[model samples]
Target: MMILALLGVLALAVGGCVCVVWAERGGPRWVRVVATITLAAGKVVQYSAKNRRRGLGGSNSADD
Candidate 1:
């Protein structure tokens, strides 16, 4: 349990550090936007690598 808690905290800290690093760097707006997108899409990259995950299946149902 203690090890799991430590890992979770470590993950949170690392993620926060990444965000800080991303925000601090100076670059063009497009570069920043691309960086943000890349950072966000990183998690989904595993699915792409496996080529098993799918998309939303044409379900554009967004209730605002």
Candidate 2:
């Protein structure tokens, strides 16, 4: 069951990557929307990690 769930998530991630590439090449409207969402999600994850590091007393030299 866990393997199946992991595979499902992997499939979604692959699909999102394909959508991102397709959108960059001027694919359909829906693809563009998906790509935008995927990018935004990546940014959110990045931001969350950064903040988490700061909360844990990471290096203060890192730029915001």
Candidate 3:
């Protein structure tokens, strides 16, 4: 069901966060790999959000 899919995504996000922390402390090669992937995913999300915001008029003020 949809709830199960959402739970799985949340689990992966948490695991990736753990890997990022472990990698920063010089963990094993696999942890480092996962951390790199996690970072890339974060960058992609940030870039997508920025683009979406720009498309929406690039304004953060409410008194527009």
Candidate 4:
């Protein structure tokens, strides 16, 4: 079951990447929308991780 879930995620990631490339080449409107949303979501997750890492150094205290 876990392997199947992993495969599903892999397939989605691959498909999203393909869609991104296709959108860059002037693909359909829906593909462009999907690619843009996927890219934005990825950026949000990336920034969230960066913020979490930055706070890990005990610098999040209110003792400014």
Indicate which candidate wins on lDDT. Answer: 3
1-64 per-residue lDDT for model 2 (tens digits): 9999999989988999999999999999999999999999889999999999887664556543
The residue-by-residue lDDT of candidate 3 on 1-64, one tens digit each, is 9999999999999999999999999999999999999999999999999999887774655547
lDDT, model 3, position 10: 99
Least accurate 10 contiguous residues by lDDT in model 1: 55-64
Worst 10 residues of 3 by lDDT: 55-64
Please, what is the whole-model Cα lDDT of each candidate in the order they appear? 0.62, 0.91, 0.95, 0.88
Whichever of 1 and 2 has more TM-score, that candidate is 2
Better of 2 and 4 by lDDT: 2
Rank candidates, lDDT, best first.
Answer: 3, 2, 4, 1
Residue 7, model 2: Cα distance from true site in angstroms: 1.1
Clashing pairs in 3: none
TM-score of 1: 0.38
For model 4 the local lDDT of residue 7 reads 100
TM-score of each: 0.38, 0.81, 0.87, 0.79
lDDT of 1 at 12: 64
Residue 44 displacement (Å), model 2: 0.9
Candidate 4 per-residue lDDT, tens place, 1-64, comes to 9999999988988888888999999999999998998799789989999989878755756445
